[model samples]
Target chain A: MSVKNLEELNPIQIDVLREIGNIGSGNAATSLSGMLSNTIDIGVPVVKTLEYEEVVDFLGGPENVVIGLLIRLSGDIKGMMMYILQSSFANVVLNTFYGKQLDDILNVDEMDKSAISEIGNIMAGSYVNAIAGLTGLTIDISPPSFCVDMVGAILSVPAIEFAQVGDRVIFIDDNFKISNDEIKSNMILIPEMESLSLLFNKLGVEI
Target chain B: MSKVINVGIADLNVALAPDILATYALGSCVGICLFDKTKSIGGLAHIMLPLSTEAANPSENKRRYADTGIAELLALMKSKGANIQAVVAKIAGGAQMFATNSSVFNIGERNVNAVKKVLESYKIPIIAEQTGENYGRTVFFDSSTGLMQVKSASKNIIVV
Candidate 1:
């Protein structure tokens, strides 16, 4: 009746998690659209079970540099959420909000860091709010932490944290599009196993 | 005419002469490279955690921790005709990529310290190291030359 590892989840359980991803990402997309005043399109969220080795390539490539915002979730859901953006897309946001353009993601200043962190916080809040409303679970999120590094390295944080429970992480992946630019941004939600079970119980799903 | 062998996270491999052993995007994970120049042999291990003793499951992959991963790497290199006595190590990619208030996330520093302890116990001198920064690193170890090239996004490539 309980699922300890990602591989133990059946198809029905997977579908339920996918539905949660859909609702959460839908709310995130709406909030992002309102912030930029642009129409946003979100792809159907996918729940993928990946090994730690494959986590790097899940974004794009291991060596590819990216801007990552990590938010830790507590209370009902204990896990991490990552907002990953490419350099070009980050530059677009910076230019749109502060009229500042960044030549490189690694060259981000403190002000730019704060801007990106705030954006991540808003998007994560929207997502958590939607999930909490649906499941009636009390969830609290920490302030977003910003980092610009290789996507492989950035994703390693979650991979290491969750490796003890299982060799694989079942993460929800959401892709977003703004205007005509099909920027490849990913929103990754990695809820802990206990939190996952709690979420499923709240949703009236048998794991 | 040398090929680059990619070592993924929680993995380890040994290479012959003229070939390069590479592990990409090492954040908190430590990539330990052991090179025997005389025989032109190199081995690399990309480890995520500090110790295997603290692992929740004993059946987990040995290459996921510094203590066991480095030991496995050395044993594999010796099997590949490497002189264990002549082997020196070059380590990179133990970085605190993000600033967090919680010390629980300070795994990067702990991993680096664990790697040092393992290598020292094995009597393998760490000739060069690039660690404890706020960025990710991709490392390439040349077996023929016993040189490790450390590359970062914002910094120039350095051969250690």
Candidate 2:
């Protein structure tokens, strides 16, 4: 399917998109805060369209990259959600869960199955719910699968890449500050090409 | 005296003496072991990706991505008086954790391909490898005898 250029989107469509990101991110933050019982500080979500290379650059470096994927099916909306976290920030989240400091050493197996799942469940569930609320739709969410490592490995899927290329992607960039350290997370929203048109129509916003 | 060193994703630790080079829970990431038979020195690196060129600031962080970590591990071996050319390599890890109809994010496959390509380019012959499946793996390499073992859901401590 041909992808519509962002420039082709009307102002109302852009506003709707931004509002969706803000609501979804905010809801995710709230859910995480309650789950961890800590005052989770999430920066105001910013929406943007970026290339694959640009997303990698925004991740800063390898040391801090933790990728997680969640699939959600909300009524007529079925999509995959992905998030990236820096290593140091990941440690903080881990520490919060354990209620103590984790050894500087990370156990990849344990973290992937345990910490990553819990976090993904909280964030993805909340985010999907927010979207459903805004669109007056019900969405079913699948369990989150964690991928720790490079983005290339995690995003090598042809369909995922195609959807990304065929849509006006929205990125929610935010930082989590815990114990004097700043960690960044990017929430990538890639609506299916058809879904975007449907969403715009539903919102009464012309593309 | 021999000592064992274990590396994990996002973290790398070293043990200078002849011992086991171990890493657990390798999924979609490569575990690289470098052994110097003469010095009985060994190092293991669990690298997640092929390169750090995309990272904003690539440095000596051994636990982040693959390219930079491999270089750093080799340099560390060189500094310890281990002959680079004499070092033998055995690698493991890189498992697909999820099943997707669309091969969009088959990270396990990509990781294995990247590791093999990089090692070949570096002229490091991988004498043994255990990779690519839906299960997780735990790898152990003994520098003293150059014996690498892998433990997974399907297999138990099989020598590589």
Candidate 3:
């Protein structure tokens, strides 16, 4: 069995991917909980196959400003992971770390950027570690590239980067909460076509 | 009460006078606004890639590439009473949102260049532009006045 594109993913294959997201985000949430020293909870992971136009609105609209951290995945499973920090989430982290809040999200200084990057690093590291452990695949991630921009612009990177293969994009949405604040940050994992096939094969799922 | 007509990513639309053509959050993608002052008609295209030739699936969608998208937009505007000789363009977006060492990630630059080349090929002069920065832009183009308002989160709004 073979899958031609992301849109061709079967129901069972989708379920497998959802489970992968579940395990990965669950591990990530635990790591975040330890780092923030707060009780972190995650909602059930959602996997959606969307068109390029729909991706922006799905991230709370195109004009929505966000902190975007991108990590390139190489080696066994090649692709990229994008971690978006919502303003509320960034505020929570900032208040916890330095007891300071950003005057404006767009004007975030280097220290704040570094802090956000570190959070992305730890969470994405744990997420990738969980996936790698489950599949026994060796994966390496590049240092995160950080940006403060509109959600539409941030998402354009992945949408254009993967446009060569297909028109549809598959994203796994993970919702996180620290105590009472519902931080709707998003972590998107987009794997290359060959890597997708390899992952399905390793998991005994027909592509 | 004029309305704002949104041209989404990989999409294009034409509007007559008194209406605004807008595209939000343009990162690496380029928004090409072609306006005919004589007719007060305008068209906008939000193109993702530089050229259609680079597309693996060339048949997918013409509006997603600079080459095909600009040509299609010109044709659309012309059909809606825009004079080809009077049509001028203003381009925006093509921002390097993420600072990376790899040239492969510089799609913003590529998109901007491709859009310029395509416009030149159609004999359309670019009247004004606010592009090639490390920030996302939301463009609101007024067909009546041929004014493009560029807005960003980190900077003051500029109209060109």
Candidate 4:
């Protein structure tokens, strides 16, 4: 069977998808709180079904230099999960991990890089587990890779894959909020179109 | 201000001298720019996949694939009175934004290789290239001088 575009999903189906995204982000927020040893809250998850080009603008613009971490998932369901912290918030995360003031510049060292990788791994791991638990599907994630790049470049990871079928893509926008700090982080999940259907079917959401 | 033309993903366009052709946030996609020095006309394509045959079904946007997009770019330039034989290529983007252990996410490398192969087949010499790194680049092609300005946060403006 051919894949269905995100536009084809009904409003009810979209709500169901948004709830799933909420659960995933809830799990990820827990992990972040534990990692930083401080309370972290997540804002309402924004779910959008957009074309590839619009997705590029979701993180402000294609040229916004942001710190991004990516993980590819397989097994019962396949997709790509990403964690993004703008350079400003990334410094806050680093300072929290290091327990000291880092330079004003965003200079991430080896340890800092690994911390970012860990962030990706933990967030994606929890998100996939949330889906797996909800739908009773087995899921496996690949090793995490971290890089500092423009939002456009990071998003292109999933964009290239989805392009094979069509221009449509499912975007799960999760915003991270840390207590007492002006910090912002974004977690975007792009699920494969086929796997998305399987998820919706298992959850009994009418499409 | 020089007029700048925007190129979309899987879409190709051409412009004349003193006009700039630009594409944004090229991560895995290759921006292929071909310019005729004498006529001062150039074209650019933001290609996603490496080959059309690799797609399960034929994509409606032929410019989405490397092989077809390059050919279309040449054809577009030719229609505008640009000499195809005199056109030289300068390219940017084709970066592995993330390091995935699995080969499925290695589309960036495949895209770079496919773009090079396509150019080679067309007998177009590549004058300069900035590809296969872990950074996203926005490239602007100046048809006036055939110089491509590659901009990224991590580096200086790469001119080719």
Best by TM-score: 3
lDDT for each residue of candidate 4 in B6-88, tens digit (9 for 90 to 100): 99877889999889999988999999999999999989999989988777886788988899999888988999999988989
Measured by lDDT, the strongest candidate is 3
lDDT score of model 4? 0.81
The TM-score-based order of candidates, best leading, equals 3, 1, 4, 2
lDDT of candidate 1 over B38-98, digit per residue (tens): 8999999999999888766744588899999988998899888888999899999889988
DockQ of 4: 0.76
Question: Scored by CA lDDT, what does every candidate get?
Answer: 0.85, 0.64, 0.87, 0.81
The i-RMS of candidate 3 is 1.1
Instruction: Write down the TM-score for model 4.
Output: 0.91
Residue-level lDDT of model 1, residues A1-207, one tens digit each, is 567888788888888767766787788788878887889998887766776556667777988888889999999899888888788778877887878978778888998898888878987887788779989999999999898888888888887777767767656676777877765566677788899898889888887
lDDT of 3 by residue, A1-207 (tens): 556688888899888877777888888888889889999888987876777567667878998898999999999999988888888889999888898888778878899888889899987787788778879999999889999988998888888888776767667677888879887767777888899898888888876
Candidate 2 chain B lDDT trough over 10 residues, lowest sum: B54-63
Model 3's TM-score against the true structure: 0.96
What's the i-RMS of each model? 1.2, 9.7, 1.1, 1.4
lDDT of 4 at A88: 68
Each model's backbone clash number: 0, 11, 0, 0
Tens digit per residue, CA lDDT, model 2, B1-160? 6555656554554455556677755656678888877787777887766566754545355455667777788888888788878877888767675666767567667767766777777788888888887656677777777788877543456896
Q: Compute the lDDT of residue A158 as modeled in candidate 4.
A: 74
Query: Model 1: number of clashes?
Result: 0
User: In terms of docking quality, how is candidate 1 classified?
Assistant: medium
User: Candidate 4 chain A: minimum summed lDDT over ten consecutive residues — where?
Assistant: A99-108
The per-residue C-alpha lDDT of model 3 at residue A139 equals 93
The residue ranges of model 4 lying beyond 4 angstroms of the native Cα positions read A1-3, A100-106, B101-105
lDDT of 2 at A144: 66
